[model samples]
Target: MRTTHPHPTNAVEPPIAGTAEARRVSPNAGWWRVIGTVLGIMLLLVAYYWVHKPLDLSLVLRLGGLLLDLAVNIALFVAGGALGRALLASLNWAVVSRGERIAFEALAGLGVISTGALLAGMAGLFRGVFLWLIVAVAFLIAMRRGGGSWLVDARAFTRALRPIDRWARLWGIVACALLAMALARALAPPFAWDALNYHLVGPARYLSEGRIVPAPDNFYLGFPQLLELLFGVAMSAFGRDTVAAPLHFGFGVLGLILVAGLVRRHTDVRAGWLAVALPLSATSFWLLFGWPYVDLAVFAYGAAVLVAAVNWREHRETGWLVVAGVALGFGAGTKYTAGLLAIGLAAMIVVEARSRALRPLLLAGGVA
Candidate 1:
């Protein structure tokens, strides 16, 4: 049976209610009612912010700019994901044979977040929507010319998970929903202390000052900034709090996927699904909900290094070695704990293939 959606923008209905995207509500016909509703919401918001401090134009502008920052960041991320999909097509198909779509989402996310950090160094002047939009449009054009579908990969991914244990499936859904709500709360102004202090402020200052320079008074200014750099870029570019936790959260999800992927690669199907589903129960994972901490980013970089290390070992591909090194370096840049990845990699080599471990270690050493 074929089902057709008359409106392309409307989401396809899911088999499970509330688990899928809901129908869109258009305000085109009830324009006056929509205006009244928006005004009412604005009044409620004003009351809330007034309770915290007071309502003012400066605060309003800052809040409004956050929206702009999120928009620019999302645009750049979509472009990066498309580029990743294009690159994945060129890589050894085995790397993404089973989880092609989710892998693309992870890789694409890494692309955008990494690009923001890498470019922030050079883009002191070009941190506006104009620059990001141009960068993003160019990618969209390039990707349109190159054919592939994220949706197709997503559908396939769902199909593969259909065979997973039903209990695991239900638990995973519950975990995902709870986590999503946690991240969603971050959409409001930052309530955490670190974010108000340096996690977000450092980047704002850096962008305003036109370079990353010393902050004599601020203690965290000297700390490693792999993840904070992205936060700062979004803030500086948009002149507001961009709520970086969700982007950071994506890294954690990518970690889950990569970890599950390795399990699937080495173990059975059921075990692989368990690997994918079981991590949501961890209390540690819940702590990261919209927090400005860098643990997830560190985990992601380390996971990338590990996954690449395994790939290089099996395929003897120098590119994977280089990737592992870059990711390790990025991890270290995010947090000092990432240095542990190098030691872990060394131990992995000693256990798996002692003679050749030094080759990758040296390569990763130079990059890190």
Candidate 2:
């Protein structure tokens, strides 16, 4: 029976259903991916155009002075910080560290610049870059000529970021991308109504006439001018409000850093990064960061206040308290809303130091 059987050569075979479906869908999937990528690119281009608007070659060309002014400001900030560090250490100013000293110097820079701008505006002195240069040079020359380095800790901090966990690295990239995008938006014409009305106008007016004049037209001009003073200096140098945007972005970054540092005290690095990501990743952050709004300024100073509080608690150092006070003052000065933040932090401080006598409360209340 087996020998008599012969198979039909034309017999049909069963179809490979998976292979058929896959073959049919594979080309469609490839097309879809291509379409999705193109759509994404187009959306990105459109967003950039909308946020950054018409590209101005003139503004691009004029950015050089802004860069120079920012550099000078940073240098001035470091030198002033170094000098403050030396003075505080020599005077036994509560055992401050280089990092704390740097923070102090930044606080000092803000106060000094704003005060100088106001005083000079009153005295008819703030006309050009010469005044800032003179002050910066004085600090640089008076930096004590040796011993502790102002930027050493900062460099070490940056280096330390290299070995962080994968989550931290991922969030860091996201944070940086957000910051860059916000900065890009900032480089364009300020679409923010408040900024166009007063923030930029106030600085522009101050820089133009070498004085901080009253703006009855817009209420924001009467608001805290601390943030604008830095911008005013740049405006004075460049004769425009071109440099203010990036300055705000920098403040946003500072806020994120301070928040992450504060959170890192009790948790893993990922938690700290998540804390950093929360604010920076929000759309509101970009809107505020790209404009001349003081919300970001509030964030920066508020975080500093909290971090300094924790630092004082950990180290029992009076310098940190002083730093916290200074930062809180600036935060309050930046916006009226900062009052709520101040009250909340005060409550936290009270709860945390309930065991201590009225001394801690007195110190905090008095300094604040």
Cα lDDT tens digits, model 2, 1-368, are 35643667677655454576565756576678899999999999999998886757776665765565456446545554555455444333344333334555555455455556667766766676645664565466546553136567556655666427788888778776777777777666567888878777877776667666777877767777777776676566556565677667666665676677656656767877778677776777667877866678788778778777776777777666676776777777777777666676677667777877367656766766
Worst 10 residues of 1 by lDDT: 18-27
* Error at 93, model 2, angstroms: 12
Candidates' C-alpha lDDT: 0.65, 0.65
lDDT of 1 by residue, 207-303 (tens): 6666566789998877888677666645655466655765666667667667777877787656665665566567666667567667787876777
Top candidate on TM-score is 2
RMSD of each: 17.7, 8.9
lDDT of 1 at 265: 77
